[model samples]
Target: MGRKEDQDKVQSVLELLKKQAPLTLKQEKFCNKACVERFLKAKGDSVKKAAKQLRNCLSWRDSIGTDNLIADEFSAELAEGIAYVAGHDDELRPVMIFRIKQDYQKNNSQKLFTRLLVFTLEVAIQTMAKNVDQFVLLLDASFFRSASAFMNMLLSTLKIISDYYPGRVHKAFIIDPPSMFSYLWKGMKPFIEYSQLVLVVSSLDFEESFEFNDYTSYPRVTSLRFDPSSIPSTKLGPCSSSRFSFTVSHSCDSVKPWYLSLTDTSASKVGPTNSSQISLGPVISPLNARSQSFASPIDRGLRRNDNFIRKGFFPSTPMPQKTQSLDPSMIHHPRTPKPSFLQSPALFFRKDYQVSRVEKSRDSFQSFLKFYRRPYDEMIYRSKMKPPLGGLISIVSPQLKRRHMSISQRF
Candidate 1:
């Protein structure tokens, strides 16, 4: 009934609401905090109810229109899991970051790409409602799975956003190929023909890209600078060399800087005994150092402990060492051919030696290899050669289908 009692009660309610609407590994915390305060102030008498409403407002629990294609099995499960994850946490709801590595097409259709992306973006956007801001995306060149059936679903969706919302995306991009965005034409070039431009960010010597116009014209890119402060000096540990982004940084610099060069001694950027050779030479220009880093999407949140809590959201996984990549081709691939059985996951799993199918198949390995090499002279193979039906066909060839009859030898 008293004024002081009312003030304390309201403050407590506001605090609880702030704690509940966690900022998680995202960028929306400041807006969330301000929004919560406003909500509480408005509903003075029943501020607890107001706080609850505010929390729900900030969450993905609210109604969002979904493209009917995604309305089926996966979307329902996704919605529930996101809400479930949000339910367990402190203040922030979990954020989902989706990036497109390739301009996706189904069989060979843009319509297919659009529909898939719509469905994907629908759920991904919904997933971002309560928890995430676009601040921290854990980008690995090998963009692996995050959750159930994620790779297929995620790639499909990211392609859509890359085509549509280039300016909005703030996640750190790694060197995943076939990914088309404002500049890169890994796959989505058809959609952006003559309309957009892609900049070559790396410092390496690249064959000239197929031409497209850069859209520095509108909302216009008045200036662009690579922010090096956000990039981590070391990706793995003390003695490993980074392949992608550092080379891009090297590309921007003149006078073979040791850090940019493959042969720098100050760096553990390479590997094993050779890592010591990878080092940044003398800093040449201040601009190069600035260009050397990717300016990370700024975090606007308060600190908690060893980890900082932006708003109320905690980092779901570890914060990534933001990397600036050269081009997709630069991400490391071993030049040597790996044994088929050792190379792929599908093969590794199905390769039970006891299986009669596998034993029969092995007999024909030489037959398949026969065509791969032309009379066994040249070792050069097209690095980009994909197998028939769209993947490494050498690994999964029709010869696999042919039954090699066993000829039991009689002495």
Candidate 2:
């Protein structure tokens, strides 16, 4: 359709939507031109259908209090990290990642989960660029084992998005989905558009394709250096017991060592002492310790000579001997010798177990391939049985054959 025709249709839909009921300020704000266009596109440019669906969506939103959903209300659900809005796709569409593994239907009610879903959608819509009305959905199913139990929740969520938030999903990807996820996918297929559904091996593929950093992963710690100067001197007090003792070492020799001190609140002498300077014991260098005798024959054999040690060939060091004897309370009976690695069950059966696992996976994948290939084969056979219609069948037959060939080659 021409630009003028599209504008007239949008205006007609907007008028019909406004006439259906007196729109509140929230409903009016929501029924913007962009939203009207989305509904129109979703309903195949039919003004009546778009207006009716848009009106029903507005009514549903009001019933659910979509605009008034506070993030704090779903704090537990948000904290679980099951679903949240983050980043954007290559098309500047906002991305919403759903961690399927974190969801537990038994712990949370269906109503609560629905509320969380609506809230997440609202947030994603709000974060979209001015011209972008849709959002990219990523379902991280790497550790998803409860596909059967989660199917209902997944279907309800997809239904809500399809029914109320039409034309709002740019794409949907299932990342590292397990074999069991096929069942969930079958149930969800009806709600999702065929072109929008994508199965990727990993989230890295999605992030790399979009050229965006994944905020879902834990951030790397740049530095772990702690400044001892941050500790207050007034809080430092004499520790009567040594059980809570801890040592803090500095890189420079000029800096004095600090010890963890616990003050006795009930004690009369609660003043600070020279506890920070108190040494736990003499520290032994690895070189000197390597020269000492070892408790085990394995350690003795692994010990290196001075020439080899100086060259950094063998870095193994023996345990240092204590200057003091162990108290009766601190002593324990000697431990029994550990069995050799060759005699262990883990080492004995690991190879056979791994082979069996590989065989099982191969069998399952082959079965999956057969299951996936049957439909295309049937389609091609059916297409062949049908008589040619204006040579349309000829064009479509090659496309189907090529598609099947490509799918086979991909696997």
Candidate 3:
């Protein structure tokens, strides 16, 4: 059929599902029109068959508690590392990588394995970008060798994906597959059409294409230096907050400043509402201001009068009101004290000998750079076994020795 006819068929199937299929409100919201199209396409455009398929899927999902599987299955760290949601392909489709370890075995029931697969697929589906609902499955089968039961479980999981999760995985990349995997691939090859499966004998191409190591299989989602939004903290394992290199966003509501108690207003009133009008006082100096009196307070019998202090510092002539305003350039503010570092005048001056030392260091560094830029063959005149130390004595002049001594002393 043509594309338009197929779309009409899908629409008809969706209408039929709404009328006949038994689906909950949650299922109806989760399963969009594109999902019904998948069911119709999987069942050969037969409305009754597609409706039945969707109803069975809904019933199975409800029975197995598929919603809680993501939360419960991630407790297994190995499983999380084995199958994770990588960043994306060039086409912007979500890429899900699954690698089976060589020593891994199914000790539990098949139900657990199935649930894990379902949970992984759901995560990939949820993480897909806008206008892109398909996924590319990158399977590493290097370690999955000579295990018939494990192979059966894998094929069965593929079968479930093909039957229920239609149109989800559009491409499959098999990496470092052994010769035995060809038989398995040939058996299930006919179920999916318009889907391509590539078997790679060498993992080099896979690593280059996806930018991941074969053994480590680190996730590309968080591996990029720029992008930090894809991978969750759970998948990376328990990372301490102190060790994280990226900035974490947090609300300032619970964070109280160190000077909050010293402010004039209560901390509750210091919210964002009064942010425009609040003014902070200058920092107080711990050193006491020098008293004018050289004698101790005990030696002074009576308190000094204000006129006695003014008469000693000010002139007796009547001052104009404008002059009494006090020029800021002449009078220093007693409220703000200078720190000890800025109080010394010697710290601000640069000596001429220090300038000469800096110039000498720069010239030496430039000479070193010029020597470093020369080719190795040009830099080394000839290859010598062990006589270079004795020959260096001929070129060692008194000026060179003095320069060496000066350089050592400067360092």
**Candidate with maximal TM-score:** 2
Q: Which stretches of candidate 2 lie over 4 Å from their true place?
A: 100-103, 183-191, 200-220, 223-411
TM-score of each: 0.20, 0.49, 0.46
Candidate 3 is scored at a TM of: 0.46
Tens-digit lDDT string for candidate 1 (124-220): 3344545443221222223323322233443444543443332324332222322233233345445532223221121121124323233333222
Query: Local error of candidate 2 at 309, Å?
Result: 40
The residue-level lDDT of candidate 2 at 24 comes to 83
- Lowest summed lDDT across 10 adjacent residues in model 2 is found at 369-378
Q: Candidate 3's residue-wise lDDT over 27-49, tens digit each?
A: 97766778887888778888789
Candidates arranged by lDDT, highest first? 2, 3, 1
What is residue 285's positional error in candidate 2, in angstroms?
27
* Top candidate (lDDT): 2
TM-score, structure 1 vs. true: 0.20
Is candidate 2 or 3 superior in TM-score?
2
lDDT for model 2 comes to 0.58
Which runs in model 1 stand beyond 4 Å of their true positions?
1-67, 71-108, 129-168, 176-411
lDDT over C-alpha atoms for residue 27 of model 1 = 22
Candidate 1 vs 3: which has more lDDT: 3
